[model samples]
Target: MRIIRTPASIYLFSISVIGLLFFTFLIKIPQHSDWIVMFALSGSILLLNYYTILIPPKGNSLSMDSSIYLASIFLFGLHSTLLVLLIYSVIFAIIQRKIAWWKHLFNFSVYSLMIICSYYAFILIDGFTGPISVKNIIPYLLSICTYFSLNLLLVGVYFVLEATENIINFFKEILKETTATYISTLVLSLVLVILMKPNHLFGLSLFTVIAFLLSLAFKQHFNLFKEISEKANKDFLTGLNNHGYFKEILEKEVTAAKENEQPLCVVIMDIDDFKKYNDLYGHIQGDHLLQEFGSLLKASSDAANYIVARYGGEEFSIIMPNTDRKTAYSFMNELRKKVNDTYYKGVEGLPYGCLSFSSGIAECEKETYSVSELLNKADQAMYAAKNQGKNLVQLYNGHSEYSVQRSLSLEKELEEAEFQLKIFLSKDVYTYRHSKRVYQYAVDFSRMLNLSVDERKTLILGALVHDIGKIEIPRDILNKKGSLDPHEWEFMKKHVTYGKDIISTNKKLEDLIPLVELHHERYDGNGYPYGLAGKSIPKLARILCVIDSFDAMTTERPYQKTKTFQEAIAELRHCSGKQFDPQFIEPFIAMIKEFETSGDEQHKEVAASIVN
Candidate 1:
């Protein structure tokens, strides 16, 4: 007979043979001395076995029965442990009618192996066979661990075959996740042993009551933890990922894609003329639009491959891993059509006449772009779609030449912005040079992030003009060699608003207002002015904040001592999520290192061109 061949079949056959031996062992050494005690323990355990707590989504289970089984091993030794385990397995199999006969046999054998190994492990360590004591603690601990290890091995082998994943990784994950529960089980088992020592029948009955009560408590606690975790990861408004969670996933996906040399696509989309819709219908209706739209995206995408998130306000983003730009664009085109067909209450009144969105797509191409750059390129494409009268899809690619016209148009205006920045002369030598350094940082960051020509133009202008508001601050406050007083610091916080006002006066620089106005806003909503937080801060503004702050720290600021490059980087890492948008931190650090490696001459040239 081909009883043992394939891994599963071999396990099945081996367990069946082992179970046959255990049954013979139980038959030979019947526990005639404690018939009443065994019967009561078995009956109580049989009832307890029917109820179990399920870990959601995966539907894996935990049971309090392990404690009783362990206690039985100490009370009645190997023979009773096997007998109780066999009876428990049979009743459990009967309740779970869908479980195959062979699986039942396997589970029985698994229990037999674990209990026998534990029984021997206890004896080998000189543990007492009955009525445990604190002196036997070492033996008891080793016995329990032996049982746990054998149980893990038996189940892990099957998991390895079924999951087709790395065995070590699976073991590590399993061990980490279940350590708490297992340790709790061990403690409970020891308690059961103590209880059973005092009149086994009465002790077992009381322990059974306690076990069921504890199981119900654990179930409630697990559910509560699951709910809180879900809330933490989700956006309160639309039920998509919050900004913090979205970046976390994006970083993970990007790293995996780069390591595997797989394609990762980013789509940054904006609902066309959403502000008009909001103004016409009010903020309540505007929120309804966001909710309705987010629901549609979440439902349409397969969550395993694509993650759709509300990218703050009217913008939404989809991160699609293992997908190229073409596939992603095609997918977005279909999604766009779906949205266009679905009428919303406020969409009909807008310029587009119906609800529509503009989307841009970009793919990861090794050294060509980083995670932020992939998203930026996608953002650029979305803007390109918006510029093409909105409600369309565009791919970030080489064929685009609208970039040329934008750069040419912004050249003269950029020169003027630099001339205006000369006003920083009266503040301090550091203030005059800081904008130059920030501007250089922005240029390299823009390239690394794959900003479109228009985006790069706007960012460069914003970086050059971000501190133009400081031009109006008193020379004493600007050049102060010490920290500003409370009143003076409060005044310093108005630079973003001031910069926005100054830039808005010139129509050519009007698009730069967000960058000027929101740079000081922190990721955690603690920064000044409006205190806008997370993705609510415009992407460019967030990018400029990182570059601008790095320059402020590393350069000779009047109020703070300068830092070395390494010290400054450590500070950035320390405050990534709280102080700056974490998405840009890695890219900014990489750009600085590259700039250093290329020699200081190139850095000098980039910074000098901003004001020279």
Candidate 2:
């Protein structure tokens, strides 16, 4: 219904007008005796529609009204069928007056069109109208098929117009779900025709009663199944999704987030000093506390469609789709304050003298390989919050963990990176020189952009190893001296992945993986790897792309011609938004012009300093 407005309104209006015209032309005045039968059939259709049988799981329904209409068409012919339709439509419109008047008119038109088409199809196929016989089976099948196809076409067109994405998948799902149900309903109509051949009123009465009973039986089964499913998926104590079910949903959401390139976050929280409260009170009182805590979490998270689950004793988790880590931290921090203010029984005996919790958030990133890894990051952050005296929210930071282990100074880290870069010297000397020049440009550019001390270090280090993946490429391709073939060009692109894998061997350098893998991505979403566009790529990676491409354009490569500094700057201007980020490219060009204006000797001195 939300899909019907403007163009859809006009579409429905046109179809309804055509249907009314068809109904007016096809409808005939029934004989005085046949009027009684038409009214009876119309009443039967109304009753059947009112008591539609809802299938379990998805809540789709089976309405027997179509069977009644098909039986009427076969028994009483076209005029009687239209008369039944008219009576049913008028009464139904009056009963369901709460629905929009236009929608009612549209529905009437759709049914009218279906009846008209099916009647013509039956007649054209030489269907016999008075009795049920084996000879007319082909006509009966054709007419029912026509009715089914017309319904699918009309409804499908409207929905397709409403939501254009995945149009082919939509029709396939509709056909798969509805084909069996529709076939059974149509076959039932034939059974009715056979029964009514002897006596109209008695056969109609028996069919209605059987259908009503079947609807009641199916309703009971659907209810039972729903209740059992809820029990299986929910935690008995907290009334939230159980650990297994939560993991199941998180895995699926993780896959969807990766495929659609959307942000997803997970928060793991633990109640601070919960064991103290449990020791003071019995385990039964602790159980009650857990229940209350789960209820609070569920109520707070319901508005965001977040999946909240009891991860274990005193620990709870929430999976937030399309949310980043910063937003997740803010929300959880607010919840922490709220929990502190809202007191629970015996919380006075606790450390903070009220309810309190520690939470940590981790956002999905390009480097996040699996759900377990993401959960581990959140767990680490949660422990970090606990170590910070509890009752706080922390966002996962990779550097925080590495600082505790290695804690290498910047100069030492630079030496480690330079050692890795030296491998390119023997394998591909051109690449080694290019990387060094790019590294130098990055140092100057980072200072010009007013980057932080840490950011400046990361940018310079990442620039040095960004092309480390090229180590895996064949020497013939790297120093080809001419254009590469299509296959060879594809093999050259694997260098980014190789670099990422190479750096991943050392946990301290995990922060540089995005720069190594994503520096080749374009600003307009045309680059290789993930094709991430605009700000979705990391800020450092975007800055590095401008520097990398600029150096590649100005420097001499075996297979490419070199451009002067002036020509390179002009090329950067032309491809600002396409190949490089406009925000960083303009500043980088300014820095190059500064070097050009200062003196050639100053630029050589900076290069010599980098070599030292």
Candidate 3:
């Protein structure tokens, strides 16, 4: 009903119904002699439809009714074919009354259109109702192709109008999924035409029986495939999803969350003092305890649509989509309390007595780079919970002691990031110098903002390596004397992704991924790779963009005319809110002005170095 309610869909459906009636009565009608054969063919279609083959692996159904219809068209001509369709549609509608009445009528119309067009095609190509012959091969192919194409167009358009599928992808998926099945149908129809030419009723019966048998065989194979696939993805002891399958689900959910701009949380939990329990109760009892715990986790989270997985050893993980860290912490804390109160055999010997676990929650943020990074954060949080006694729930805090330690290692990490940055010196001296200038600006701007020590360190390190992705660009494009062509410009834009990939290789530098990948993002949502807008862009990335762009505008390049510092500063001011964030522009401009007015020896030294 919803599908037919749309104007385009209603028009298509109405035209199809009108076309079917016009062709059935005016253009063609079954002769008195055609009644018996029509009934027989209709019966065969209903029987074949009931016993459709269940294809293996994906369990897609393959109906042999199309082959029967094609064979009827080839053997009995247009009038008998239409009569048979009329009988089959009426009988199918009666047997399938649970389906909506409009759906049944729409299906009948679509089939009628396919049969009418295909019959015309067969006749136009000099096809006749007779025994198979080599001379009629072209007609057979053309008519069957017409039937298939019209089926796709009519049905696919209805789905597209109803908002059920994307048109291009719908066609592509249908062609890929149905090609082999349709080919088999074409061959089977030809065989049926050959058999029915000599003895119509007997040939239909034999083909129907064989198809039914094959359907049964394929159904068994499909069942086996599903059985094996289930076992493969399930853990043996706990019966939850295994480590590999959990990762797959996490990756898919993370990607979906990022695209939909929804929150996702991952919680890593470990059974507290499990080794001590195993030492007191032996491995067999430990196995039982794990099974009980796994069942408890499944019971607790399944109602909320959380995916629970065994993360190996005594650790378990839960993927909670559309949940923030605070909600995740609350859910996990309640579970932790429930677990602590629940009694298990041999638990009295463990550290806290009764069953207990520690959990850590990490919410996927706008700047969270990868699933691995998310998991690492949760794993760290879980460990932090464990360090603060056994039964506890902790949320990941970016400014926690771990972050302080990371900041303390800024000098060492900066040295490593610079070593990577130096690769650009050989590739593009302009980019190398540009990165260094941005780094200096970041240092001054960070201090001016009075940011936290960790913030200062991260901002400085991020600016230093923000353009490290440029190393992947071809030197010719990197140093092109003229403006890059559109394709070259698009290719150059991939540096951010390349930089993210490069930084992700080293886990310690993963914190800088947002800045490296998002520095090109604009405040107004017009930039790539993701067009993140306004405050949604990370603050460090926003600052880095200001520095990166100002340096790019002022610094010398072979490709375009350069602007002076004063001109670049004016341009920055003019583009505020549209390109640069308004809050940071004046402070940055002031920093540059202070350096210029000071007539600093450092500037002269840097100028001398560049000239040399």
TM-score of every model versus the real structure: 0.63, 0.69, 0.79
Pairs of residues at least 3 apart in sequence or in different chains that clash in candidate 1? 373-449
Residues 1-612 of candidate 3: C-alpha lDDT, one tens digit per residue = 344367566766686677668665644565565677788889989988988999866788999888988998888777777778888989999899899887787787888888888988998978887789898899999999999999998888878877667688789889989898888889999999987877888888888889989988988888999899889999999999999999999998987787577899999999989989988889999999999999999999997889999999999999999998778888998898888888899888876768999888889876666788789878877877877776888888755555456578765888888898888867888887888777877887898996766678888999889988988989989989898999999999999999999998987787788899999999999988999888778788888899999988987888878899899999999999989899999999998899899975563355357536
Better of 2 and 3 by lDDT: 3
Residue 406 error for model 1, in Å?
A: 10
lDDT of 2 by residue, 1-612 (tens): 576457666778788899999999888886754677788889989999988887877767899999998888888888888888889889998999899998988899999999999988988978878778788789898999999899988877777666543457668878888888888888889988887889898888889999899889888988898889889989999999998989999999987787567899999999999999989998899999999999999988997778899998899999999898878888898889889998799999988899999988889875464687688778867887887889988887744442233234544677888888888867888788788888888878988986645567778889989999998999989989889999999999999999999988986676678889989999999998988887667788989999999888887789889999999999999999998889887788888888888864554554456445
Model 3, global lDDT: 0.85
Give candidate 1 misplaced runs (Cα > 4 Å): 1-27, 33-36, 39-62, 252-264, 302-305, 321-324, 364-374, 398-612
Residue 584's lDDT within candidate 2 is 87
Q: Which has the higher lDDT value, candidate number 1 or candidate number 2?
A: 2
Q: Worst 10-residue stretch by lDDT in candidate 3?
A: 602-611
lDDT of each: 0.78, 0.85, 0.85
Ordered from best to worst lDDT, the candidate numbers read: 3, 2, 1
Best by TM-score: 3
Error of 1 at 375 (Å): 3.4
- Give one digit per residue, the lDDT tens place, for model 1 in 1-612: 545467766766876798668666654446475766766666777766665655653345667677777887877788877767666676778888898988888877887788888888988978877887888889888988998998888888887766554588789878977777678778878888788776787777788887677567767877887788889989899999877788788988987776566888888899988888888989998899899999999988855458988788888898898898778888999999999999888676887688999988888765432465567667767877887888899998633554545455776798889788877764544566777778777777888887767778778888888888887777788878898999999888887778878887887666678788878888899986778778656778888889888888886777899898889899899989998989889888987887678775665665556455
